[model samples]
Target: MISSTLIFQSEMFSDWIIYNDETHGEYLVTVDHSEDTCYCTCPDFQYRKQTEKFGGAKLDDNEHHCKHIRKVIQDGCS
Candidate 1:
């Protein structure tokens, strides 16, 4: 079950900033629910076309959900 707290703490859910630490550097990450995916400013997303193919796995953890999204649900529920 998705927790309401997770929704409250998510930058994606709250219109805050989201970023990813990459090999090259840090890049902004954006979540697109309509498409059920995330876009990062990193080279992996920009040049390789890996983002579209592996976006879901990259975001999901053991719970089959992204950490950011999970945080939002937890925070929102709390």
Candidate 2:
């Protein structure tokens, strides 16, 4: 199960504190609906957030795609 807590919310912005079950690591997630982007205080997210594709057509949804971001979006940003 995913463990997360919504720390802040507003019309266009929100913040979430989520834990990685595997490592039990905590990360701060920020979602901005106005920009249609999400950010996470995690190395994986930081490294891959700007990557469009990894191995010539492997593909990604967008520039701001990651597990933490997905978790936030899954929780419903709108």
Candidate 3:
């Protein structure tokens, strides 16, 4: 099972942290407006989502939602 907890968040709720119970992994996630972009420190985001095909752009705009990023968005940045 995977889950997330908000460790820190800016007033705008753009940046925060998420942790995994099973993997004991901590991920940093950032949500940026003007694009609703989500960045995650997890390997999935670094190696898979953030790709080299589009000159280092996210691999697939519609499919780049990493677990950490999705959790942040679902949590309403709370």
Candidate 4:
């Protein structure tokens, strides 16, 4: 299994898909263009989203994103 996160995107497409590896297993994180946001199956993402919503804490902001999402962007599409 791939230990590191894998990012896939195309120049023509605004959406991105990441193959993220977790302790339990691997999950896919999709950056949906229509929604203009990223969604992940990992619990961390869900919890953070809800916490940020209620806590009014900006955890995933412009310069910050979930580890999975950050990996995708940092890894690059090329």
Candidate 5:
């Protein structure tokens, strides 16, 4: 787990986007307020289950957080 805290303002939801360094691309990151979760089009998030099973590092304590989450937090997704 990366012991870092990334905070985002509540209003950043509308402008939140996911950027990929490898592909030099960007995608919209959707947040499900009702479910209190976020989703991304990146392959990391798409195949997170397999990644975790293979012992890839988790973004947070649990398997919930990922690079996408870190990006959102670092970008101030408020």
Candidate 6:
């Protein structure tokens, strides 16, 4: 879960930003602006979201965004 008080700092890259979350022992969150994607190297991201087997069906929009991604957007992204 994303905390209302958690703050993140990001290191800018050419196409993505590396978000550093201090609340979780400086965990890194990757935010890809070009692809409008976000990923975290956390257990939650791996177990919950990434484990989904889409099979032959199209993925739902709600399935893509995680708490890390939401934090990045909440920090300041239009």
Per TM-score, the best of the predicted structures is 2
C-alpha local distance difference test of each model:
0.39, 0.66, 0.64, 0.48, 0.49, 0.45
Poorest 10 consecutive residues by lDDT, candidate 2: 51-60
lDDT of 2: 0.66
Q: How displaced is residue 75 in candidate 1, in Å? A: 13
lDDT of candidate 3 over 1-78, digit per residue (tens): 556666655654366778788888987887654344567787778887764443222313537778777677676753
TM-score of predicted structure 2: 0.71
What tens-digit string does per-residue lDDT give for candidate 4 at 9-64? 54432334444344445656555443345555566676654233322113235343
| Candidate 6 residue spans exceeding 4 A from truth | 1-24, 51-63
Note each model's CA RMSD in angstroms. Answer: 8.5, 5.6, 4.1, 5.7, 7.9, 7.1
- Model 6: per-residue Cα lDDT over 26-59, one tens digit each: 3445544444445556566656665335211112
- Could you tell me which residue pairs clash in candidate 2? none
Off by over 4 Å in 2: 51-64
User: lDDT for model 1, on a 0 to 1 scale?
Assistant: 0.39
Q: Which ten residues in a row have the lowest lDDT in candidate 5?
A: 1-10
For each candidate, what TM-score against the reference?
0.35, 0.71, 0.67, 0.49, 0.49, 0.47
Least accurate stretch of 10 residues (summed lDDT) in model 6?
51-60
Residue pairs with colliding backbones in model 3 are: none
Q: Candidate 3: TM-score?
A: 0.67
Error of 1 at 1 (Å): 29
Give the runs in model 4 whose Cα sits over 4 Å from its true position.
Answer: 1-24, 50-64
Q: If candidate 4 were superposed on the true structure by all CA atoms, what would the RMSD be?
A: 5.7
How big is the positional error of residue 59 in model 3, measured in Å on the Cα after superposition? 13
Order by lDDT, highest first: 2, 3, 5, 4, 6, 1
Q: Which stretches of candidate 5 lie over 4 Å from their true place?
A: 1-15, 20-22, 49-62
The candidate scoring highest on lDDT is 2
